[model samples]
Target: MRSQPWRPQRYATTAVGFLAALLAFILLDAPMVQRLEAPTLDWRFQLRGPIAPGPDVVLILIDEPSLEALGGWPPSRFDLARAVERLAAAEARLIVFDLLFATSSNSDEEGRADAALAAAIAEAGNVTLGYAFTFGPEMLTRLEDSNRPPDGTALQRYRRSPQAISPLPHANGTLLPPRSFSGAAASLGHMSVLLAPDGALRSEATVVAFEGTLYPSLTLQAARQFHRLPRSELTADVGQSISLGDRRLAVDSRMRLPVNFYGPAGSFPSYSLFALLNGAVPEAALRDKAVIVGSTAAAAVPVFVTPYDPALPSVAYTATVLDNLLLGRSLVRPEWLRGLDILAAGLGAALAYGAARRLHPLAVPLALLVPGTLWTALAYLAFVQWHYWLALAVPLSLMALAAGFGALMRSQAEQRRREAVARERQNLSRYFSPAVAERLAAKSEPYSLTGTQSATVVFIDIVGFTGICEALPSERTIELLRGFHSRVERAVFGHGGTLDKYLGDGALAVFGVPDPLPGEAACALAAAAELQTSIAAWSDELVAEGLPRLKTAIGIHHGPVIVGDIGGESRFEFTVLGDSVNVASRLEGLTRQLQVSIIASETTIQRAREQAGTAGGNIPLGFHRHGDVTLRGRETPLSVWVWRPAEESRVATRRAAV
Candidate 1:
């Protein structure tokens, strides 16, 4: 088999895979960089006041129309007075404004409006206005020091939001801060923002860091407002709980919270400014419902960009934050998840390597895909159910590792195939003859013949076989047989012969069994002559050892014979079967009767004569004809020959030596 250039190596494969994983890891940010993308959480005094110490909450927005109808910028302070009057009329347990009035009024009309507002404030002792603190600590501290609680009033349970103290920036966009303001209203809380990981509103954020201090986000604030729950009543571990005198309200324990954005979207609660001011909503609805006021005006504002407000109207943002708390559908990524991310990545990589190590190359894809699916599911659960952001880097890296390792192994396999082929080619020539080796190398597999068919056969038997065996001991006979067989085998091989078997004093050989060589008759005769000469030359050694000399008679014939492996279940021999083989054996028996050491068919005699004449210097060979003969089990006659050395050739060749 030929080797391919693209082979996979186990070690190199591992290396390439790890390298790919590392590259991907670096590109995907092995260490995350955090960015904040929350929108503005600012609201007017009307929405911020009366938000705390109360039932679970939902923030209804009172937007731009209210501004237009009541007159803009410090809308008839008297109108805000009317808003309070309305709250008092509704018998609301708490009234928190979403508005702020920072500067003092001086004009007679404004003064009158202010007096009216103050009068309403005095009347509605339950009202609390929203106030914001600017960036600097000293400025906030000064304001905190100077702000006195009303005569018998208590300080707010929550402090100003540090995040609002200063604006935060992220790579994608800015988390806008409101125009910082501080007001005389009590029960004020910093309306802060929540951020998404990529700075997009695809998911919600609950917890945020502000000015070195973490704060409850917009949804939490809205939740606190809805239930009139003070910060003290809300437990981070058990969600929110509020007890307003006798009644109690509850919210989930796990979040700042996120809204489930049900699509068939655009269902956000939006209130036209005019409708809200004219008491368009039933007083019963307004009485206790938390009103979180913010602009839904189409124009983007410096404070309109809340984290959850991306592409949503600001009113929707308010609703989203509020509803998120009520439904416990907050998208709160776990804060202490650095450990999980690292663990996930490490486990994923290890699993990939393990799979690569243990499984076949084909299994690597399944290894990667299976784990990838698991990770995705885990990520979804963490995001939606558990509100945690799980790192996706790990499992993805594992996938890359498996694939990369597989590719490397594939390349290495090809390399090994090439090497194996080279080794095989190198060793093949040693086992087979040059001709056989060449044939084996030409195609798909080794050239071999386990079964056989028609072939010419030959068998040689010594003249005094039984007598020699009687005179010699078994060991000597064995040694003599070994030596004689060795010699015969050499001659047979020289003529491209296959030795089939050997018994007491003779062996069978075939010229055309394994491969049918042309001139089989000629080659067999030459081999026979060589065998005779070889034995005759060994006479000196026989004399020295005081052993009888050996002489063999060769028989040759051409006829169809089944030449192949022939044996029992356990042992087989590549030999011929049929009348032709039997005839050859019978012919061998007649060599002694014919009184010549070599006998061959007329076919062998003729072909030998022609070959000797054509290819000179073949051997010291000569032949004589033995007339037409019939052998045992033969249906037709065969004209045969008894061939010997040239000097004695006439003895056998002359008619009727018998």
Candidate 2:
């Protein structure tokens, strides 16, 4: 038999799974989750290890040895001018300083030193000087008029688009070199770095907004000069990318590029300023290469943490940015990637929910892990192979939430089903034997109790119930009926028959109802014989107690009948309903005229013989053939058999004589 139709619980469970995923997606931008996600990106970089750097850029550090060679902390401008002249003479493609020359000397001797440095910068014609921007509270007090750079300075030659709104980092005031020094420089750009939330340097702003104009970074200016592109080739598209001739460098919404470091500090070729100035390092080493000069001396410049090194010198950080710009290998985390992350999270959650619903309990964990592991592997491969950053934490959280919630919903639904089964068993006990009811209720899978099947139907009644009731008072009549019902229940249930229901003075029982059993006809025949013996014993007790004796008539028939819970919605009964039932009732009435305690149709007797087979010796041999008689509702006459035990016959004869 088939189970009932689909229910709402399944739909409710699916909806809950999707809802959990949506909640996770909403919290993707929370500060705590984002903080947890940051370390994952760091782990990817560490796992990829290090790569070889290109031979296009080099670092010249003013190390401790160079500082000692120069006599003290502040090197003389004359020495700095000599270093510039040497790099220019070597025909270096670009010379960028990760330093600020914002002040001039007070002594006559040092004044000439500053003038000599300016003349050296002009003669070189390819030096890009570094500057700084003040963003502190002091910037608020400075007048805008005094903050402007000198006219015709290198910073003004760069391109600035009027239509593009300024989305780059804003600068409050400038820290430029003296006018004599700046006027002679070929280019000027800011040397500013912003730290990550964790105090690690990972990205740099390619351009900064200042006084209604855009200023390029030190690395950007060096890239422009190294390529020999005119000022118009360097263009900033705020919140998108930087257009450098035919190539576009991707940037975040804030116009920042994620610095892809080749390795730790000294990843690029390096030399000491002392060696370069003293002619110990060959001049040809600087030929056709862009050079960055910064101080590696203790406390000389700020040191920041990077993915590869905990204390990376600021000069090396600038070199990393320039390397990315020249090679077009910067890490990209564009705004559109966030949309893809959300889609992956949503789909993964839904798939996890479906898997948890159908898979076994032990396999559920594996099901949840599969999607999470696959996404993580894909994200790592993308980062290693293509420098693409994919989100890790948010999508995993979504899958876990959906799977857990789906499991909880399934557990609750199971609990509900168990409760329903318990109630059904309690109801079934009213119309069936305890064993039958328990068997029906304990099924692991769903089943239906309504169907058409062949069974043996038995009807039993008190032969003179009406006359006996009149002779007794109301209370006595109830007691008499209870005694008779108790005996009938024992006889039917003892032989595995269903006690369908009780009539006012009679009861109907059936074999093979709800589910069919083997040898059901024999079981029914045995129940009929047991009822005859039980009622006779009860009648003798009543006679000894000076009350009316009890007598019962039973009829048994074997045929097909429809059995199930049938009636109006308000009240229903599990019973057998067919012509077979009517035939059994009519046969029970015939017992009175036949003067026998039991009268069974020939069909029932033949079925019993067939089912008993070689075990027929166990069956009682007291039945006698009776003449054919037409039942009340049927045109055909049915042959029947009657049985009258000797004890019952003697009891009846004595009553007739009296």
Q: Pick the candidate with the highest lDDT.
A: 2
Show where candidate 2 strays beyond 4 Å.
1-34, 72-76, 102-116, 136-141, 144-168, 366-370, 405-454, 460-495, 499-507, 513-555, 559-579, 587-658
Q: Which one is best on TM-score? A: 2
lDDT values of the candidates?
0.54, 0.79
Instruction: Please provide, for model 1 over 434-536, each residue's C-alpha lDDT reduced to its tens digit, 9 standing for 90 to 100.
Output: 4533454555632334544545577888777789889889998888888887788778777766667776688887765556566666767777888888888
At residue 642, give the lDDT of candidate 1. 76
TM-score of each: 0.49, 0.75
Clashing pairs in 2: none
Candidate 2 RMSD to the correct structure? 6.3
RMSD each, Å: 14.2, 6.3
What does candidate 2's lDDT look like per residue over 1-658, in tens digits?
1323334544654575557557655766575786667778888889999888778888888999899989876777788788888898888888888878877788999899999989988998888888887676557536454456655333333433554445456778888788777788877778877666777778887777776677778788788888988777887667677877777877765677888877888899999988888877677889988888888887777788888899888888888888888988888777667666777677777777667766767777765798788888888988888888778888887788777766766667677888888888877776677899898678654443455689989999998889988889999889988888888888888878899999988999998886776677778877888888889888899999888888899988989898876667566667898888989999999888888878888888888777775333234656767779888878999999887786665675688799
Superposition error at 511 for model 2 (Å):
1.2
